[model samples]
Target chain A: MKLDSRKLKILQAIINDYIMTAEPVGSRTVAKKYNLGISSATVRNEMSDLEEMGFLEQPHTSAGRIPSDKAYRLYVDKLMQVRSLSEQEAEYIKDLYESKIMQLEQVILNTAKVLSEMTNYTSIALAPQLSMVTIKHIQLVPVDKSLALLVVVTSSGILKDTLIHIPEGIDSDYLYKVSNILNAKFRGKTFAQIDIRDLSDIRNELAENQKFFNSLVDVLTTSFREAENREIYLGGTTNIFNFPEYQDIIRARSFLNLMEEKDLLYNILVNSRNGGVKVSIGTENPYEELRGCSIVTATYSLGDRVLGTIGVIGPTRMEYSRAVSIMDHMGKALSRYLTKLYGEQP
Target chain B: MKLDSRKLKILQAIINDYIMTAEPVGSRTVAKKYNLGISSATVRNEMSDLEEMGFLEQPHTSAGRIPSDKAYRLYVDKLMQVRSLSEQEAEYIKDLYESKIMQLEQVILNTAKVLSEMTNYTSIALAPQLSMVTIKHIQLVPVDKSLALLVVVTSSGILKDTLIHIPEGIDSDYLYKVSNILNAKFRGKTFAQIDIRDLSDIRNELAENQKFFNSLVDVLTTSFREAENREIYLGGTTNIFNFPEYQDIIRARSFLNLMEEKDLLYNILVNSRNGGVKVSIGTENPYEELRGCSIVTATYSLGDRVLGTIGVIGPTRMEYSRAVSIMDHMGKALSRYLTKLYGEQP
Candidate 1:
C-alpha cells in the first residue's frame, strides 16, 4: 500500500528500461535485464501495485506497461542521479565562448546548436528581452534621398536597426542636429523609461519638424513593441527523428510544428526565469503539444538579472539525469560568457 | 519514335496526376482522369517510351510510373503555364510591406514564409551579399569599460553591428576621433574598395593608437569574411512531410540536413543571380541530396543590380507551374520594395 523502498526501486527499473528502449516494460523483461533481486512473479505483482498507484499505464494494444509521467517526475526528483558533465564536456561548453569573438546573438545561437548536438534533443536559446536595457547610442544614416537607417545600440549588447523615411525638410545638417539631441536624451534611458513626456520634450525642441518627429516616434515605438517578442533560436529540430516516439509521421510533424510556436516556448522559459534548471515532464507541461514531451530548461543569468534560457526538449522518457546535469553546466557556462560580454562596467 | 503532340499531352496528364496525388501514375488512370482521348493501351505504350527517355522512373515495387526531374524541367519550360497570381495572392504579397513598416530582413523572411505556404513547398530567401554595398555611415557606442558596439550602415539598406573591445588609454573622446576618421574613409566606399591602402591610411592617421587599431582590424576582417557566407532564411521545412517522397525518414533527414547547409544554397542562388527564373531539375542539381528534388529560383533585383534570390524546393514531381508563378511574383514584389526603400538618388 505504501511507496516503500522496494516498490520505488522497481519503479525506477521500469522507467530506466522504458527510457532506453522507448517501449512498454514487462515485469519478466525487467526481472531478466536488471538485477533487482526479484523473481518475475514478484516483479509482476509490484508492477500491478505501481499501476494501481498511478505510476504506470497500460496501452490498449500492449500488454506491457509503461511508466507514467508521474513516475518520471519522481525519478527526476528523487530516483535519478544528477551526474555532472565530465572534463571534456564541460570544456566544450566553456570553449564555445573562446572559439569566437561572438556577439550575444552568435553565442546564443551556437550554444543552442551545440546543446542539441551534445544532447541529441531539440534545443532553444531564447534571446534576452532587452527593452529595459539602457540605450547606449542612436545614429541615423542616410541611405537614399528620402530613406535612412536608424541604428540603436543597447547596453545589454542588443542592436536594432530600423528603416525610416525622411520628410521634405530633413537634410544632412538637420539629421546631424536631431541625432545629437537624440543621443543627449536617449543615451542612458531604457525604452521602458522613455515615455510621452520624453516625446513631448523632443517635439517641443524640434516643433517645426513635426513630420520627421512623427517618423522618429513611429520607429521607436515599433522597435520597443517588437522587443516584447523574444526571438528563439532553435537547433537540432530534425534530431527528434532519432527518437522512436517520433516514428509516427503525424506525431513527428506535430512536434516539428510545436518548435515553430515561439509564444509557447517563450512563456515556458519566462515563467522559469527565476533560477536554475526546471523540468516539465509530459502532462505536467501546460501546452497540449508538449503533453507527450518533456522540456528541460536552465536559466542563464547575469548577476541578479535573468537574461534568457538554455534548454532542450525530448520525449517524456528522457535521459533526465544527464539532461539536467548538462543543462546545469551549460547554464553556468552561458552566464559566465554573458558576464564577460555584457556584465562589464558601463 | 518521333515526338508528337499526343505523346506530350499524355506525359503532361501523367505528371499532373502524379503531382496531385503524390502517387505513381498508371496509364489507365491517366487516360480516364485526364480525358486524353487515347486508349489505355496507347497511354501505356507512351509511358514506356517516356520511361526509356528518362522522363519517368518506374519504381521497382510499383507498376505505376512517376515523373523524373527531366520531365518536370520539360514540363516547366515547354508545357507548364506560368499563370500570374490571383488578385488575392498578389494583394497578399503587396500587403506585407504596408502592414508593417518592415525592414529588408523582415520583408525577405516573410516572403520566404508566404512563398512556402502558398505553394506548399519548402522556400528560401537568400540574404543579400553586402560586402560591395557602399558604406553610408559608421558609429561606435562604448558599452562596458572596454566593450563597444560598432554600427555600420550601408546604402543598400543593410546595417551591421559588431562588438569591439577597447584597449587601455583610449578614452571616449579618442573613440569619437577614430569614428570621424573611419567615416571619412569608409563612407561612400564598399568593403571591396577599402583595401590595404585605406587601412594604412587610417593607421597613419591613428598612428598614436596601435592596440585599438588592431582590434578594429580584427572586427572588420571577421565581418567582411562572414558576409561571404550568405545567410539563408528557410520556411515550411516540415511541409516536406506532406509529400510521399519524404515518407522515408532517411531521405527526409538528408533533405532537412541539406537545408542547414548554407553554402550549398549560397552557391545555387549566386549562380542564378544573372537570370530571371531558373528551374534546376533532379539530376541537374549539383548537391547529391538534391538529386531527387526540383528547385525553382527567381532572382530579385534593384535596377540592373541583383539583390538576392527567392526560391522553392520540392520533390521532382513538383507543382512547377504554381511554384514558378509564386516565386516570380514574390521576387518582383521584393525587388519593388527594395527599389522603393533604397533606390532613391543618393
Candidate 2:
C-alpha cells in the first residue's frame, strides 16, 4: 500500500484528468491520453492499489476511479508542482493595481472579481479587520445646524464615516472648537483605550455645548463598532452552478445557502493560522455544508500584521495547482500593494 | 383579431401557468388547470387567436404555447393583479430596517439581499449619486503629525471619508482652524462651488502653514470626486441558474457578464426616469446581453429627490406581478426610512 513513484504518477494523472473533464479517470484512458509509458494493465493495478490505500475512489463497480480527498491533500502537499501564472495573468494582476488609484476597499473588491473571473470559481475576500488598528483622527463636518457627519480615520488608512444628529443652534465655530480640543486630548488612542475617564476633562471644556459634545464623544468612542462589522465581498457566486457536481438542485442549494452566511465565511478565513497558501480538501473543510467542496485560501498581510484573507471555492475536483498558485500570487501582490500604501504609518 | 374577453382569459392562463411551471401551456392543460369552464376546442380556438395577436408563442408545432414578450407587457400593463406579500415576507423587510440603524449604503445592500433571497433572483442596488447633494459639513481628525483624515458630510446624510498625508509637524490645531474656515465659507455649497478663489483668502490667513493648508484645501475640494463614483451592490447573482432558461452555459455566461458591467447596470437603472415599478421584458431591455432577461426596478426617493434604484433580474418568465409588488413596497419602505433618517435638512 506504499505510494511509490509510479503510484503517485497514476494518482496525479487521475486528479488532473478529473479536474479538466469532471469525469472519473479510467486506466485505459489515462494510458492512451497521458505519456506515462505504462501499460493499461499496470495503470489499472496501481489505481486499484491506490484506492485500497485511500488515494483514489471508484464511484461504481465497473466505472473509472477519481482521486479521493486524501489523494488531493497528498497532491497539494507534496506531489503537485506549483504552476507559474501565465505572463498575461501576471500582467492582468499588475494592470489591475495600476489601472487606478483605488481605495483599499475597491482594491479588495477588484481582486476578488479578478480571481473569480480567472479561475471560474466563486471568490471571497474578507475586508481587513480594523479593530486592532488604532484611531488616527476623527473629523466632523457640518451639514447643517441640526446634524454633523462624523469621520474616523485609522492609522492604517482605513476611513469610516457616520452621520450624527446635533442639537439646533450648534454653529460651525462651536463644532470646530470641539474638534480641536478633542483631537488634542484623544488623538492616537485606540477605541479600546478611550472611555469616560479620558473624555471628562474635554467634556468639561465643552460644557457650553455639553449635549452635542457628549454625543460626539459617544460617537467617536463607539466608532470602531461600525468598522468591526467586516464586510465579505463575494464575486461570481453563480460560478459554482457551472460545475456538473453542483448542477443538482440539492447540492446547489447547500452551496448557495453556505455562501450567504457571511459570518461562516469570515470564520473560515480567520481559522487559517498562517499567512500562507492553505488548501482544505473536501471533508477537511470544517463546515458540514462545505464538505462537498474544496477551498484554497491565502492570507494577505500588511507589514507584520495579517489583515485579511482571499480564497477560491470550487468542486473537490478543482484545479488545485492553478488556484493555489494564483491565490498565492494575488496574496503576495495585495500584501505588497497594502504595504506600499500604508507602511509609512506616521 | 378584435379584443375579446375569451382571448384575454386564455392569455392570462397561459402566462400564469408558464410562469409557475416554466412549461409551455397547452390549451387543454390551461382549460383544466384554470377552471375556465371552457371546452378544449373552444380554448384551443381562443389560444390560436391570441397567438395570431402576438400574445403567445409555440416552441414547436406540436408543443404547448409560452407567453411572448408582447404578452408579458400586456399582462404587466393590464392583466396581472399585484400579488400581496406574505406576512412573513412583510415582517422580514420591516425587521431588517428595525434591526439596525443602517446607513444608506447598508440599507441598499440589505435591500439587494432581501430582494434576491426572497424572490430567488439576482438583485442590484445603486448607491445614491453624490453630485446632486450639497456639502453640509466637513471634519478633520488628526491621525498623526504627517497624516489627517478628511470627512465630508453631504446635506443628504451621506458620510464619506478619505485619508491625506500632511507636512510633518502640522498639529491638530492647524487642521481644526482649516476645517473651521472651510465650513464657514463653503457650508451649504456643492462641490461645484468650491474653488481656489474661495480658499485664497483662507489660504492667505494660513500663509504661515501654506504648504499644509493648500494640500488640505486640495484634498477637501477633490474629496467629492471619489464619492461621485457610484457603487453598485449586487446580491444573489447565481440565482439565475435556478431557472431552466439559463441552464445553458452561454445564456448563463451572458447574464453573468452583463451583471459584471457596473456601468451598464447603472445606466439601465438611471434610464428608468419615473418613480414606480418598471418592467423591461426581454428584448425591451436596451442592452443586447440582457435581451433574454427581464428587469423589474423601483426607484427609492429621499424626500422629493429620487436617490437611486433597486432592481431584480430574472429570466423572462419571471413572476412579474410578485416581483413588482415586492419591489414597489420595498422601495417605499426604503424611501420612508431614508426620509426619517435624513429628511429634515434645515
Candidate 3:
C-alpha cells in the first residue's frame, strides 16, 4: 500500500508489458523478461501488494495481472518516460509541413492525416475559432442578372463566401460600384461590431436599390455571425479495428459512430480545458461512449489566444508518451505557423 | 443452357431471397416462400439450368444457390421491380430539402447524409465541376495589415474564397477601385478565357502596385485554374459494418481506405460516364478492391450541362432496386435545385 520504489518498479513492469503485448503480465514472466535483479517469488509478492493497492487487477483466478485505469493514470502522470520521435518519423513530419500549403484548413487536415498515420490511431482536429476575429474586407460580385456573391475576409486569414439572389437590371458595372462603396465602409470591423454599428450612409447611397442592398448586408451579417462554427477533421477512423478491444463489432460500431458526430467530437476536445498536453485515461473521459478509450489533447494557440485543440483517440493502452510528445510538438508548430500567417503576437 | 421463362423466375426468386436473407436459397425454400406453383423437383431442375447458364452458383454441394454477378446484371437490367419509398421515407427527404439551406456545399453534404441514412449504405457526392462555369463576380476583402481575401463567384452558383498575403500600405479603398476595374474587364468571362486573355489594360491601371497586382492576378488565375479539383462529401461510412460481406475486418478496412482516396472516387464517378442511374455489380467494377462491392451512380445535370455525380457503395448483396430508384429521384431533385440556382438552361 505504501508504493515504495520496489512496488513502483513492479507496477511499471506490469504496465509496460501489458501495453506492448495487450496480455496480462504474470510475476514469473516479468521476472524472466526484465532485469530487475529480483527472484520470481519476490516479484510475485510485489505484484500482490500492487494489486491490493488497486493499481493492477486480474481478469480471472488463474490469469496474470493487467493494469487498472488507476495504474495507467499513474504511469501517464508520473512514471512514464517521454520518448523522442525516431529520425524517420521526425523527417516524415518535416516533409509533410514542407509542402506548400496555402490555407489553414489544409494545414489542419494534413495534421490530422499525419498524426493518424504516424500514431496508427484516430485523429481529430478542430479548426480555429473565428468569432472574435475582425473583418478586414467584404466584396460583392455579380453572378448573373438574378444572383450575386458575397465574400468576407477576417483578420486571422479566414475566407468565407455566400451566394445571394439579386434583383434584375443590376449590371456588372453597377454591382462593381456598390461593392466598392460597401467595402470602403465595412472594412476593419468585427462581426460583433458590424452587427451593432449603423450603416445608414451606405444604405442611403444605395437607397434606390434598397431591396438588393438590404439583402446583401443581411447575408454578410449572417456569415460573420456563423463564423464560430468549427469544422472537425477526422482521419484513420477504421484503425479502431486493429485494436483487439474493439474487435467486437458492437464496440467498434459505437466508436465509429461517435467519430461521425461532429458536435460531440468538438465538445470532447473543447472540454479538455487544458493549455498544455493533457492525458485523459479510460473513464476519466467525460462521455460514456468514450470511457473505454484514451484521449491525448493539446491546445494550439497564438500567444494567449487559443485557436483550437488537436487530439488522438486510442484504446486505453495507448502509446501515451509518444502521443503526448507528438501533440506537444505539433501544437507548437501549428501556433508558429499561424502566428507567422497573421504577422502578429496574440 | 439458355435461361427460359421458368428458369428466369427461379433465378429471380433465389437472388431476391439471397439478397434479403444473405442465405443460400434452395429449391424447396423458393417453392414454399414464392408460391411458384411448381414442385421442388421442377424448381431444382430449373435452378440447375440457370446454374449451367452461368447465372447461379453453389457455395457448397449441400447448400442451395446464390446469384452470381452475371445473374445480378440480368436482374438489374430486366427483372427488378421499382418499389416506391415508404411514406415516412418520402417525408424525411422532403423535410431535409425544405430546411433553410443556402449554400450548394451544404446541400451536397446534406444530400450525402440523407442518402446514406435512407439507403443504409455509404454515400459519396462529388461537387459540380467549376472550370466550365464563367466567373460572374470577383471581390477583394482586406484581412489585416499583411493579408487579404479573394472571393470568386461562378455562374453555376459555386463560391470559392482564398486568402493571400499583401504588401504594406495598400488601403481597402484602393483594393475596391482595383476590384471594380477588374470586374469591368473580366466579368462574364470564363476561367478558360482569363487564362488566354491579355491583361495589359488592368496591369496599366495598377501600374504603381505592379508587383502586388501581378501576384494578385496570378493567385486569381491559379484559383480559377484549380477550379476543376472536385470536392468529395462522404457520409455513413461506418454503415460498411452493417453488411455481412464486410464484417471481415480486412475487407472493411479496404473499403474505408478507398473512400479516403478522393481522386480514386472522382475517377470512379467520372468513369461511370452515363447520365442516368448506372449500377455496377460485383466483378463488373473496374477497381480490384471494389470488385466485391456494388456502386450505383447517377449524374445530376441541368439541360445539357452535367453538374457532377452522386453514388452509393455497398456490398454486392446491396438492394440495387431501392438504391437505383433513390439515385434517380435525388438526381432530378438536385438538377432542379441547381437549375433554379444558376437561373438558366444549359
Candidate 4:
C-alpha cells in the first residue's frame, strides 16, 4: 500500500511514541505530543489508513494504536532517526575499549556486560573463532613417562593446549623430532585447509617411528578441533523478566529455555556472518520462540576474515536506532583492536 | 516439636503427596493413599499439631495443608527417602563418563547438561580450580620473530597456554636457555608458591640474562593469576518455570536474576565447601533472592583436596530424595573419572 507524506508522518509519530511509552498511540496523544500540524480528526483518519496498510494495531476500538511488526520494520528501515550516543554513553564505550582485557574471553564478556548495563537489555558476544586464524606454531613438552602436552598458537595471538598420552618408552628426543615435523608441515595453514592427505604424508614421513607419529597426529587433530568449545557469553539474561510482556511465568520460561540452547544462539548470530552489522526485529527471526525479541548483532573481524559476532538482545519494543548505532561503533572498535593486536588491517 | 513415629509418618506422607501432586494434602487423602495405619481423624490431629509447630501451612482456614519451608527442611534433613538410580539412569551416567570430553570446560558444560536432564531441574557445575593443581611442566615455543607461547601443564592433565611478546632482538637460543631455567625452578611448584623473592634470586642466578629472566617471570606470574577465569556452567535454568510457584513472572525473573550472577552461584557452591554432600532448603540460602528455591549441592574432590562443586536447583516443593541421590552418584562418578584421568586416587 502506498503511503503519502501526511500518512507517513502520522505513522512515524505513532511508532516513536509507542517505542518510548510502550503504550498504544492515539490521534490525541500524537497530536498533543508531536505537533504534526494536523487536526486530531485528520490525524485519526491517517492512522486508520496506516492501520489498514498493516502498520499499526489497536487493542480495542476505544484504545490507542501500537506499531505492528510491519510498522517497526518500516521505521527501522527508513523512518527512525539514528541517534548519536550521549557524552556519558560515549565515555562508557571508550572506557571499555581502553580497559586491559587479559584474554579474548574477557573482552567479549566485558563487552556484553557493558552493553547490557548501558542499554538495560540482555547482551551476547561470541568469542573469536579459531577457524579464522592460521596456525603460527606447535610444540610438544613431555609431562610424564606416558603423557605429553601439545600447545598451538594462532597468528591472532590465541593460545590453546591439550594433553596426550604417549605410549610407554617413548623418549623426549623422539617427541621433539615428531613435533618439529608436524610444525613444519602444518604451520601457516588454517584447520579447514588441513586434510587427510596432509595427515597421510606426515604419517608416511614418520613410518619408522609409527607409534610416536600417530600419537602426535592425534594431539594436533584434537587441539585444532578444540574450536568447537567456542563459548557464547550472555549478559543480563535476567532482564527478560523485567519486561511487562513476560510477566506471565510461562512466557518467561520459554524465553529462558531458548536462551540456554547454544545452537539457538549460534543461529541467531549466524545472520551477521557476512562481516556486517545486522538488526533482526521481532518476528523477523525464523525461530518462533524469539518472535517477541529483537537482536542487534555485528561481526568483529581481523583483516577481511570475520572472527565472530557481538550482539545485544531485548524485547521487540527496544530502541532499534540506538542499538544499531552502538553495535556499529563496537564493530569498528573491535576491528581496530584486532588489527593492532594481530598486525593486520581489515 | 517432638513427634512420635505415627505423627512423623503422617507428616512425611503429607510432604510426599504434596510434592508429587502440587496440591494441598488433606488428612483423608494422606490416610487413603499412604496406608499409614491411621484413621483420617488421627492424621488430621497430627497435621494440626504440625502446623502449630511451623511444619505446615494452609492456603485457607478450611483447606488441606502444604509443606512450609520448615517442613521441607525437616523432610530434606530427616524424612525424605534416599534411593539409588534406576537402571536407565545409571546407563545415562555411564554414557556421560565414557564420552570423550576433550577440554575441562567441555566436561563441566556437558556434566551440567546431563545432570539437568537426569533430574529435570536446573544444574550447576563449577570448573576445577588451578590453584590446587601443581605445575607438571612448562614449555616456551617461538611462534614468530615477535612472539612466543607459554604452555603450562598441570598435574591433573589440564594444559593452559598464553601468548607472550618477545622483546626486540631476543633470539630463540636465549629463549631456550630461559625456558630451561624456568623449568628447573618452577616445575613441581604451584603458581602461588612462586614469589618476587624467588624471581630476584633467579634474576641473580641468570646475571647478564636479567632482561630475559624478568620477562619470563612476568609471563609466568601473569599466567598463574589468570587462573581466576575458571567458569561455572548452568543448565536447564528454564526448568524452574515448570514449577507452579514460579508461575508469577516477578518470582521467575527474580530467580533468573539471582542465577545469572556468577558471584551468587560461586558463593552458593563455596558455602557447601565442606567435603560432603549438602542440602540447602528454602530460606536456607544466604541470599534473599534465592529464598524461594532449594539448592542440593555436593563438593567433588581430588583425593583429600576439594576441587569444585556440582549441584541441582529446584523449587522448595522439588523431589529432594531424587536430587540428593543423583548429586551423590555424580559426585562419586566424577571423582572416580578425575582420579583415573590423573592417575591418582582421592
lDDT at position A299, candidate 3: 87
lDDT of 4 by residue, A1-346 (tens): 6799888888888888887887888899888888977789989888888889998899999999998888888888999888888899888888888875546667777888888888778888888788778877777778888887777777677767677777778787877877787788778887667665677877877787688677767766765575644578888888776677777767777777777777889777765778677888889888888888889899988777788898998888888999988888877787777767775312
Candidate with maximal TM-score: 1
How well is each residue in B1-346 modelled by candidate 2, as lDDT tens digits?
6868878888888898999999989878977988989888899888888889888899999999999999999999999999888998899889877855537777788889988998899999888877656677676667766767776777567766666778888787777887788778877776666665787888788888778776776666666465454688889977887888877666766677788788999898887747888999999988888877899999988888778889999989989988998998899999898888877555
Residue by residue across B34-105, what tens digits does model 4's lDDT show?
997888998888999999988899999889999999888888888877999999998998999898655666
What stretches of model 1 exceed 4 Å from their correct place?
A: A60-62, A140-148, A168-187, A344-346, B60-62, B142-145, B168-173
Q: CA lDDT, every prediction?
A: 0.82, 0.81, 0.81, 0.80
Local lDDT at B265 for model 2 = 92
Output the better candidate (2/4) by lDDT. Answer: 2
Which residue segments of model 4 deviate by more than 4 Å? A219-230, A344-346, B205-219, B222-230, B344-346
What would the TM-scores of all predictions be? Answer: 0.95, 0.87, 0.92, 0.94
Best-to-worst order by DockQ is 4, 3, 1, 2
Tens digit of per-residue lDDT, candidate 1, span A1-346: 8999989988998898898998898889988888888899999889899999999999854588999999998999899989888888888877887886556788889999999988999998788767546778776755556777677777667778787888865786677677778888888887777775667778987788788788889988877677654799999998998998788878888899888888888888888787899999988988877898999999987655777887999999899998999999899888887877677363
**Any residue pairs clashing in model 1, and if so which?**
none
lDDT tens digits, residue span A1-346, model 3? 4989988888888899998888889989989898799999999898888888899899998999999999999999899999887898888777877776678788889999888998999999988777656666566666666777766666666667677778878887787787777677766665656653456777887888989877876776676667675689988888888898887877888898899888889898877646888899988888888887999988887556777889999999998889988888877777777776664423
What does the lDDT read for residue A265 in candidate 4?
Answer: 92
Q: Which model scores highest in lDDT?
A: 1
Per-candidate DockQ vs. reference: 0.57, 0.37, 0.61, 0.68
Q: Pick the candidate with the highest DockQ.
A: 4
Worst-scoring 10-residue span by lDDT in model 2 chain B = B220-229
Q: Looking at model 3, how many pairs of residues clash? A: 1
